[model samples]
Target: MTKILVVEDESAIRSFIAVNLRRQGYDPVEAASGEEALAVMEQQQDIAVAILDVMLPGMDGFAVCRALRERFPAMGMVMLTAKGQEQDKVQGLQLGADDYVVKPFSPKELLARIESLLRRLERPTVELGSRQEASFTSGPFIMRPDQRKFYKDSREIELTPREFAIIKLFMENPKVALSRDDVLNSVWGKNYIGDLKTVDVNIRRIRQKIEDKPEDPKYIQSIWGYGYRWLGGD
Candidate 1:
């Protein structure tokens, strides 16, 4: 059974989520604080997903999310933010979380988000008769989809799974102005329920990693009123 970590200070809420997860056949490991969550992660390295509540007693979910992202790049994460906390949502995404669910969210919605994330994280396989995937090269950057590795100027840049997917999409469609919907659909799936600003936040995070000047991005250019375009080549 897949294991999911639920870190929420409120015991009632945490228990509620755990029960729902268990009903869906997931083994949920519960924690009451960020510190405990990290400890749980240390002991259970095989945990597939973490659902972190933003308002915690200590350390807070954002900090925990950052720590988890740095320690386990491939593990999926979903932030639980209070409804109307727009900044919290953006901060979680910027900190490498795959998705966010507002408080007062239904179990169905939460499960859907988790299911979508798991789908995104699933490793791709090459069939016996299929051609091997090729590496993408854009100027100094190289991305190997099969290896799930990305490098710039011979230096490897660590990226979350979502970040990798977004960059791969941009590289695959170089010089084309892709609308926000295009990116959201390609990376987050068409059934994703969230703000379009999620796309902008993710793009900003990517620029910080790849651009020398994120304030004035060179490779990932903004299309203004549309979305963004990738400008990279030999």
Candidate 2:
């Protein structure tokens, strides 16, 4: 059974989500606080997704998301934010969350987001039946799809699953200007119901990891009023 962690301080909301998850055949691990969520994670290493509520008793969802991203780069994360809290949504994404759900969201909507995340997490980094195509290099960066690893100048750089997918897409289509919509459809899928800002935020996060000066990125250059392009080569 697939395990999903639900961190919501409200008993009613937490129970509501857990019931829905159980109905869908997922094993829901409930945590009332961020601290408990971390404790649960320590024991439940098999947890594939974490649904974190932004308003928690202690150690807010942002902190938990950051810690989780640092400790478990591959684990999928979804933030539960109150409606109209745009900053919370952006902060969650910047902290390595794969997606966010606004308050008062239907169970179906939340489940859809979770399923989308699972699909991305389960996707093969490289196509099967092509051992020779398992790895690729662009300038100083090396990506091993089979191993799900990336390195810059021989040093491993930890990337969340979403970041890895975005970078892989960029590296594969070097020099081609890809609009935010293009990246959203390719990485997050066409069915994704989110703002285009998601693409921008992820790109910024990727730049922070891969570029020496994120403020003035050399490899991933933004095309004014359009999109972004990757300049591959040393």
Candidate 3:
């Protein structure tokens, strides 16, 4: 049986997911906080995935994720943060999170993202071993996808995971316009149900970090009615 762990504070949300995972034939374990999670995790082995909420009363989700990875490096981690907590989710990635699902998430969508993460984890890392190759360069920016880091003209730029993912997307497809929906589905996950403005906010944050003049960005060019694109300078 595939074991899964859910660390959420809310009783309803925790139970909701637990019941659903059980229905799907998964051996689900629930913990209300990071402390509780630790106590339970030791007893459970082969836990394939974990769904964790960002804010807990004590030992927030970020710390818990790191501890979990130390023990089960291969375990998939899905983070849940509030609607406006982009920074929190971004920080979570540094600790080795596989994916994130923002708050007000439907149980179904949560399950789907979980399944996708688990499936991706299921793939043998053999082909991925030692061969974790990635190379892409953008205007004034250097990308290391495997490491999820970005540098501007050799100066390291601290990009939030969301910012890094968005910038990476534009870099991979420079000069190609992408709509808000496209970005949401790709970076935020298709299960994202947040407002479109969330994209704009993240864009503004990224521009501030990458653009020489965020007030009038050149690389992350806006497309008016369409969206934005990375026009790497020549």
TM-score for all predictions? 0.96, 0.95, 0.57
Task: For candidate 3, write residues 63-118 as lDDT tens digits.
Answer: 99888877766577888988878687667665667677888877788888777666
Local accuracy of candidate 1 as per-residue lDDT tens digits, 1-234: 999999999999999999999999999999999999999999999999999999998799999999999999999999999989999999999999999999899999999999988877776445546765788999989998888889999899998888988999999999999999999999988988997999999999999999989998888999999999999644
How high a TM-score does candidate 2 get?
0.95
Candidate 2, which segments miss by more than 4 Å at Cα? 123-133
The whole-model C-alpha lDDT of candidate 1 against the native structure comes to 0.93
lDDT by residue (38-103, candidate 2, tens digit) is 999999899999999999987999999999998899999999999999999999999999999999
Question: lDDT of each model, Cα atoms only?
Answer: 0.93, 0.91, 0.77
Q: Candidate 2, which ten residues in sequence have the lowest lDDT sum?
A: 123-132
- Two-way lDDT contest, 1 vs 3, winner: 1
Q: For candidate 3, give the lDDT of residue 99.
A: 71
Model 1 TM-score, all chains together: 0.96
- Candidate 3: C-alpha RMSD to true structure equals 6.3
Poorest 10 consecutive residues by lDDT, candidate 1:
123-132
